[model samples]
Target: MGRAGRKTVLFDEDKPHNRVTQESHGFITQDGVKPSDFKKRARTDVQKYPSVSIKEKRVEIIEKSGGVFRIQTKEGKELYGSM
Candidate 1:
C-alpha cells in the first residue's frame, strides 16, 4: 500500500524471535538467513517509504463506525483512519 501512495501504519511489539537457532529457507536468495537479520532488513526497507510508519505500541481496540476506523493503543493513544 505504501508503494501505491497510501498511508500505512505498522504496529509491532518488538517481541523476541522464537526461531533464533533456525535458519529461514525457501526464500530464494534469502535462504539460510537468520530470523533477526531478515526482520531487521525488512523493517529497513519498509521504513524507506515516506508514506509508511511504524508504531511500537500494542493495539487495545479497533472499532469501525460509519466509514471511519478508530484505533486505540495500549498506551492511551487514539488514531483515526478512513478509506
Candidate 2:
C-alpha cells in the first residue's frame, strides 16, 4: 500500500507483553525473533514510504458511520478512513 501511495497508519502500543512470557514464533523466517525486533523491522520498512504514518498512541474507540471508519485515540484525536 505504501508503494502505491496509499495512506497507512500503524498504531503500536509497544507493550512488553511478549517479554514477560515467551518468544514469538510460528511465522516463516521470523521464528525466534523477539517481538520488539520484529516490530522495529516492520516499522523501519513502513517508514520508507512518505504516505505511511505510525502512531504510538492506542486506539480508544472505533466506529463505522456514513461509509467511513472513525478511530478515536487515547489522546482524544479522531481519525477517519474510507474503505
- Output the number of the lDDT-best candidate: 1
Over all chains combined, what TM-score does candidate 1 have?
Answer: 0.77
| Per-residue lDDT of candidate 2, residues 3-39 (tens digit) | 7899989887777567664556887898888877877
* Tens digits of lDDT, candidate 1, 1-83: 88777999988877855555577787779988887888899899999999999999898999999999999999889999987
lDDT of each: 0.87, 0.85
Q: Estimate each model's TM-score.
A: 0.77, 0.85
Candidate 1: Cα lDDT at 13: 79
Regions of model 2 farther than 4 Å from truth = none
